[model samples]
Target: MDLFPPDKILVDRVKNGDREAFTTLMERYQQKVFQTSMGFLHNQADAEDLTQEVFIKSYKSMKSFRGESSFGTWIYRITVNKAINQLRRNKLRAFAGLDAMKGEDSAADTNADAPLLRKEQKEQIKDALTKLNNAQKKVFVLFYYQELNLKEVAEVLELSPKATESLLFRARKNLQKELD
Candidate 1:
């Protein structure tokens, strides 16, 4: 059963000091936060922990949420920032433990297999994406995977639409080069 009618309803309830309403908001958005984190961190445990942190932080700051943007978008922005920070830390740690991260060991899923050229293509894409600079990767993921339009992407990234477009262009060029 749904704990609240909708996010807006819950947001109003939360603004009125209803903890349960806030919990509902967390429940509704947790998987999205986790997936967003995973797209950057690529580790289940870390992603899960970060998702939890994102909600906790959001809940604590709920009083300040003055409906500037939709609550969902605000939460998404928080999750992305948390994920980016983790990615930065991960890059630093990568140098310290070179052996463990090698060849599928640190990949998001250590599953069995998918088959054929599509699987190869998927792997290639993942590899290419990882090679992108952070700014380019951010635009690529937000635009391509999250399906945000250029304007929405700009809002999230705090970039001009033109800058976001250029980042995406460079990102795609880099990916295509890596794939070839």
Candidate 2:
């Protein structure tokens, strides 16, 4: 009747020195981690690197994994914090161009206007996102890009559900103002 093996079983196995169980756990969540990283970073290579760091940190911090939350939520918190830290560390270098995360085609495209039009729109949105404070940005990214539910976003943000809702509302208002 269970959709998947319980995380506790896998965690116990991992703690008991079962390397395969750890591998299985990583396989199960790697894509989710990667996608979350991509949403935060917007760069495939950086996302991949952050994904690896997330798993490595998770493995090292396994002792702190109390079953209070799902393994997925715990891993997500770690991923979010690390990704934010990486952004902070490289803010000057990465944000200097503001196009570093965006892929550019060197060859002239046949449909030039369309590509330029979309890139301009995306740049507008990215500029709007940059206006958000870290907490607002975190909530916005998790809710929109990561497609996490209100409850999930609350858990990831470590905020009460009501507080998370308020944060999301304010983030939306801020974004709307920026874009408009």
Candidate 3:
């Protein structure tokens, strides 16, 4: 009935400085962390870097593990925090592009007739996603891209499951509206 071998045993091994146990933990969760970060940041390179940072930070703080939550949950918290921070920084950069009107003009001219094509439709979807508010974007990414069930998304977002569902519903509705 145990999905994890034993948290206490693994924790003790890690505390006693067992590098292999740490590697096992990292291997088990690295992909999940990277996927979750990519869902938030929407960039492969940045997500990969954030995933490494999350594992390092988790390992450094593992000695304080009190067994109150699963190790998975603790690491998930770190991944979410780092990913959110990265997204905010990226948003700032995108907004700062407003200063370069010539750059915006050039992009618009290059894509002048793009809206008439299928490839442009995909680009429209990407643009609509970027337009979503932060909370809506977070809920949408977690629900869809991360493939988290509603309950897990609720836990990560610190919302009641009902509230999480509502958020997801709203996010989808907004995305649909934007795409339309």
Candidate 4:
């Protein structure tokens, strides 16, 4: 017998009020959801918080899941929406000067400068991602960070494969321009 049940079976169990089944589902996708959230927010704590939010929202709405797409795709859609909203909230806080009051952490880095360089590069990439349009950002994040193939990205974004490819191309071009 297979040690793991399929997601469809698990979804059915959850619909029947099996909380352990829902927990199993969460274990299956939590890391992917966290990576998706991190790709958008670029902050660990924010990503973790968003991951919890995604699972909570998923649990609440599991009954409404039409299974039109795969369970992973459905959860990814939720993560993307929540992460984007969080980014918008952060932007609003910055625009209102509230972010400034939070202040930066001044942890002493006794290590070498290599980590600093990598951190700077990571920040640059994050900024470049932010410059992308919403569609392009979604494509880039799903394809690269979440490691979804073009077809999977398309399914998540509800775009044709050709459209997803074009958006990905434009996103790469724009990101190259931004980084340069």
**Structural similarity to truth (TM-score) of each candidate:** 0.79, 0.83, 0.77, 0.90
Candidate 4 weakest lDDT stretch, 10 residues: 103-112
Per-residue accuracy of model 2 over 92-161 as CA lDDT, tens digit each: 6656876464435311222356676676776677678867888887888888877899999999878999
Candidate 1 wrongly placed segments (more than 4 Å): 1-6, 98-105, 114-124
Using lDDT, give the best candidate's number.
Answer: 4
Write model 1 residue lDDT over 28-143, tens digit each, in one string: 88877777776776657777989988998998888898887778788878888888887777776776775365535544354446555655666776677778998898887777
Residue 1 miss distance in model 4 (angstroms): 7.7
Candidate 1: lDDT over CA atoms? 0.79
Number of clashing pairs, model 1?
0
Score each candidate by Cα lDDT. Answer: 0.79, 0.80, 0.76, 0.86
Q: Write the per-residue lDDT of candidate 3 for residues 46-107, one digit (tens) a residue.
A: 67899999989988998887777778777887887787787677667768874365434433
Ranking by TM-score: 4, 2, 1, 3
The residue pairs in collision within model 2 are none
Clashes of each: 0, 0, 0, 0
Worst 10 residues of 1 by lDDT: 103-112
